[model samples]
Target: MKDQHEPKTQSEWQTNLEDIGAKEGFYEALGDQHTALFVERGDTLIVTFENLDHVYERGADRMPWGYDFVTSRGWSMLGLMAHDWTWYRDSEVHDFFDRLRDEGFFERFSNVIFYGASMGAYAAAVFSSAAPGATVICISPQATLDREVASWETRYKKAWRRNYHDRYGYAPDLVADASAVHMFYDPRAPLDAMHVALFRGANIRKYRCRFMGHRIASLWLQLGILKPVIEGCVANTMTQAEFYTLLRRRRENGRFQKEMLQMLQKLDRPKMLARYCTAVLARRRGPNFRKALRAAEEQIARTNK
Candidate 1:
């Protein structure tokens, strides 16, 4: 038999949420589609949105994306989980938020911040309207899936059919009353860039991640800058200069280097590839870099001959 204290399995994670909910704040099933898990800590609250599939994929013991991070700072957390990629478009879910707003739940917190990535980011942005002055930090968030507003969006085909004409429909418009909105996305990602373009207002602050693509959140986590970036945002201390300075940590990241090398290879620039590999190998032992450098040298020699 497994130890009672052993890490909870994927299914058990759901059970665990229920258990925690029974003891602490509350965990309510919004509908057959979504669930809400609230854990109170400090006066500040970090509201996060996540896909249940992604949560379970993280292995047994892992919690929501910002669960550990938020709690570590002694802040409260309200994790909104979607059963699938429904984009959290459910009447029950809307009603739940409406209830929370009516009860002045958000007003209890000294500060409130809505956070997520991708689809979750879209939810975070749209839902921040529930608390007018809340700050929003999202990565690669879609402004809307409404075909009328985002005709060029070919992705999230299922979501295209969902209604974006009602309350909290247009993410960009919903976030207009927010105290601040920070958007992170790679300008290199055509679709992502196009989606972000719909968001306009003085409250919007866009951070370009360049070649980082649509999954800049994961990359920032890998580079060990995710937490600091969030901390800065929460504290209202994040400046463009400070963010870029923290982003420099990517220079030593293997994945970052590999992606850069792949771009060089795609451009057929062996010289730049060689120099990149040499620089990486000089500072650290990278088998991939070493191998690429050899191939680049061979290509250069053949071209010279």
Candidate 2:
């Protein structure tokens, strides 16, 4: 039997909560509302919402790439605080957006991108839809208000329901006007892909990355791999195929090579080395039979030392 007292893993926590009564417990724990803003030099905007029961202070460092991207582009940021997932009353979030609109935040900026991971991703998707031409990129987003509320009830039943009812109103109803929606998910995750599929906005893109585990890992991958794609999409610099080619080439070049070499040295395990060598050789050989065997042998010898 599992240790009842031990801290649960994220998956375990989620599962246990679901098995219990997720909806009832969640709505009872709603707390204070707070928001923070970070302004950059350029005319871009990024709004982030925190997860349930999480304070923004705890998660500020979680998205460095997001901060870096906005600052680098001279954009400004708005970070919302939710005592738990249910902190943002629907009126509050909408009013916040209205305030931004009134201040010409979106109108003045050349580009606006709404981004978040997990619960924050849910907020980004729902809110960005309200902006006329904003682009949204969500990593592992929860697709529905009802599901999220139900799932949280195990730990925060009352707060969850209250939040679902009071703040967001409903998840499906929140995403009616998104300009462009892109979602990334791990295929192995236990949750269904309904949320990602239901985003029938004007422009929608969905990608499944099998290697990265669910949660923040996928977000990190997006930083390294999706940056250019996002920039291209926003700036109209390259088509998706062209952008992907560029990103893949960059990964294959010196940076990825150096990183892989360092990892090999650290692990110092033969099986890993062999796997690495095989992958490298296979990538090089393409469809050629003789070249593959020769390349694999060469890689093995090099790594063996």
* TM-score to native of every candidate shown: 0.92, 0.57
lDDT of each: 0.87, 0.54
Across residues 230-277, which tens digit of lDDT does each residue of candidate 2 receive?
566556353556644654553344334445545554665545655665
Off by over 4 Å in 1: 1-3, 6-12, 298-305
Model number with the top lDDT: 1
Badly placed stretches (over 4 Å) of model 2 are 1-31, 38-40, 50-65, 81-91, 102-104, 147-159, 165-168, 171-173, 216-223, 236-305
Residues 170-279, model 1: lDDT tens digits:
89889999999999998889999998998999999999887787778778878889999999889988889999998888898878888888888899999999999999
Which candidate number has the best TM-score? 1
Model 1, residue 151: what's the lDDT?
A: 90
Cα lDDT over the full model 1 = 0.87
For model 2, the run of ten residues with the poorest summed lDDT: 21-30
Give candidates' CA RMSD values in order.
2.2, 12.9
- Per-model clash counts, in order, read 0, 25
